[model samples]
Target: MSRVLVTGAASGLGEALSAAFEARGDEVLRTDVSYERGFETGASAPSSTSGGYRLDITSDDDWAAALAHVESTWGGLDVLVNNAGVAGGGRLDVATMDEWQWITEINLFGAVRGTRTFVPMFKRQRSGRIVNTASLAGLVHPAGMASYNASKAAVVALTETTGHELAAYGVTAHVVCPSYFRTSLMSSLRGADTALAEVMSKLVDESPVSADDIAAAVLEGLDRGDELIVPDQAARDAHALKQTDRATYDVVMRAQAVKLEEGAR
Candidate 1:
């Protein structure tokens, strides 16, 4: 019966996560940019014991309004999932400045803002859990996904720091670094290279996981108070490779990037 707030609740991991939490009898407040017709899953934008609302994670005002609602309604918060993110893709040389800004604002700054806004309340209550959804791309550092990888990597750092800061207050932070899965996240992605997109799409389709698996892993991780939750085997292996051999890993990744590009040609 934890009071939970999940961003990007409209679909994919977020939607499935909301339903999962609600099914567990926990109070869930789902929020996103809009609650349109097709957003029925995350479209419950009105604040209730089991409903949601429109919350643009990139806006300070929107964050404040949502927190205000929580103050008046729930009176306190327990879990916050900074799960709202849009995909941005490109190599560092050709990537747009605006694209980097856009991606960071939502993927990184949005999480920072959420945690900043809620920290006071968490301190007051002296108990909270903040879960951030990063990606294997962050750890794997795959080429052509520079923007996405950098932003998600920053999230991991942010959450680790926040966890350290809030541990004294009984507030914990969890980071979920997951590999490809069946999710609506692909719908929000925008790419400049069709070849990269084709390769990623093929790899993702070949991935043996689903959004539900990720959600389930997050829940279990939260329950176990595990700080780092790598949901699937692919993500685990990626993190391990980087851990075991940094220089060799980098060389291999660069070589793979070359091969991927050549294959695309």
Candidate 2:
């Protein structure tokens, strides 16, 4: 069985993924910002054999500590799943610099840090898997979620690039582009201002997929050695749209923008 490390293991998709791996007899090291709570409530409860760590993905020091702990305890990691992220709401014009920075730091930079930090270790092993959690929003430019979309899109690009570079080492990289999975991501969506909360809420409610389904898709993709894992039917449809009709896709996204704004009001 593979030795796996999953970030954002406190709840939602991360927790589920950790459990899935553990159930298959793989050793899992789960990490999140809330160590005690996540361990007691999410990771440990589902699989007592899995280890837990308090990890702040935005901090390089924290990543170093976690990596060191894993190396000391497990010898080497076979899979690294960068599953931690946050969602932000608002048009690009209305988002504050701080807000954009905060989201990107976690959603984009967090994954980059993990990949950079872990690649050397994986190279030493000469075989490993890196799974980056992106979103359907990355493929289709949705309105009022510019920062979130951009961060996920960056993940897709990073995963593709890293996959190419790591091929010679037998280390495979996979990008998971999931449609709205039922997770705290929606609950955490930051508004440009308080007034935009209603619009964000509506958008989240319309999402068609669940975290469990996405987790299943992720496992399947890993098994199949797929480079891009579109987890849900809606996400697959969106990806196909981007490939088939660029102008029509733009028109649909513009209409979504109008709807989002009207919902906000």
Candidate 3:
């Protein structure tokens, strides 16, 4: 089995991913900012894993500690899953500078930090995988999600570039661009637009898919060596519509935009 490290493992997609990797007999080191916050805020932390540690992706020190832990505990690494992120969005002029910075720092820079820290180890081993969790918004770019969409889209680009740059060294990079599914990700949602937030919340709550379903598809995609994994039918359909029918795509997108405008009013 592989030796895997997952960030944001306390809840949501990260929790599901950690379980999925463990179910496949891989040794997983789960980390999350929540784990750190538990100590800082005096809240109850989640059940401890054998090698799990508190990691705040925004901190370089935390990233360094994680790498040290992996080396000391596993002796080698196989997969690095950069899955920690917050849910955030706002319409163009409404999004605050602080919100943009917050979303970008975690959603985009968190992955970047993790990948950078682990790349040296992977390069030395000459075999490793980087799995980044982006979102369908990264590709589809719907309305009222400027910050979130930009952050996720940057992740997509980072993964693609890493895949190309690391291929010769036997390293592969994969990005999961999943649509809204039942996940505690909404718990971390933040934005200046309350209306947009509610709309996103409804979409997430009403989705027919679950985190487990996405995790399973992610593993299957990894097994197949897929670089881009769009696991859900909804995401696939949306992306396909964008690619094959631009006019129809614009109509649907604009209609959603109109609804957001109405909601904000």
Candidate 4:
């Protein structure tokens, strides 16, 4: 069985992926910033932090320690899923630089740290897979998601670069760009942000797919040797729309901004 380490494995897409790998008899090592509050598990309240599996993606020391743990326990790693992410809603006028830093630290740099820490190990192994969980926002930018858009976009770029470099060496890399799913990512956004949350929730509610659907897409992408794995129709369409008919996509995005402005008012 493949040995896999999934960041943010306690909840959402990460949780689903962990289960999927485990079901295949893969050795799954789960890590998150904190397990005490079940933020890792999608619970809204803070609880006591669980030992051993706790990993703050922002910390290099934490990365080293986790790598050490994997080396000591699993002997090696086969897959690294940089899946930890957070959501927040704010534009330039309202969002603080601190907020931007926080999101990038987790969303962008978190993945960076993981890639940097693992690339050498994978290189040594000469066979590995890096699956990064970016977002549709990376391709289809929208208002109230500036930080998220920027961060995930960087993740996409990073994974793409890694793929270009690693493919020659038999290492595989793929970026997972998913649209809204029936996960707690919307609820996990900073502040209440309920109006936007409700908007996202409604979209997912009306959609035909859930986390499991996206997980299946992820595995399919792996099987196909796909570079950019857009898991949902929304993401696939938006990505194509952005590239093919950008003017229409821009107009639609502007309409979304107007709705958000009116809601804030």
Best by TM-score: 3
- How high is each candidate's TM-score? 0.92, 0.91, 0.95, 0.88
Clashes in model 2: which pairs? none
RMSD of 4: 5.1
- Worst lDDT 10-window in candidate 3: 38-47
Question: How accurate locally, in lDDT, is each candidate?
Answer: 0.84, 0.82, 0.90, 0.81
List residue ranges in candidate 3 displaced over 4 A. 36-51
Q: Give the C-alpha miss distance for residue 108 in model 1, angstroms.
A: 0.4
TM-score of 4: 0.88
List CA RMSD, all candidates: 3.2, 3.2, 3.3, 5.1
Candidate 1's residue-wise lDDT over 147-188, tens digit each?
999999999999999999999999999898998887777777
lDDT of 3: 0.90
Clashing pairs in 3: none
lDDT, candidate 3, 116-218, per-residue tens: 9999999999999999999998999999898999999999999999999999999999999999999999999887799999998998999999999999999
Candidate ranking (TM-score, best to worst): 3, 1, 2, 4
- Residue 29 miss distance in model 2 (angstroms): 0.5
Candidate 4 residue 215 C-alpha distance from true site, Å:
0.8
Q: Candidate 2: how large is its RMSD?
A: 3.2
Residue-by-residue lDDT tens digits, candidate 4, 89-202: 576677778878888988999999999998888888898999999999887899877877899999989998999899877898889999888886765677334566557668
Candidate 2 lDDT score relative to the true structure: 0.82
Distance from true location, Cα of 20 in model 2, Å: 1.2
Candidate 1 vs candidate 2: the lDDT winner is 1
Q: Rank the candidates by lDDT, best first.
A: 3, 1, 2, 4
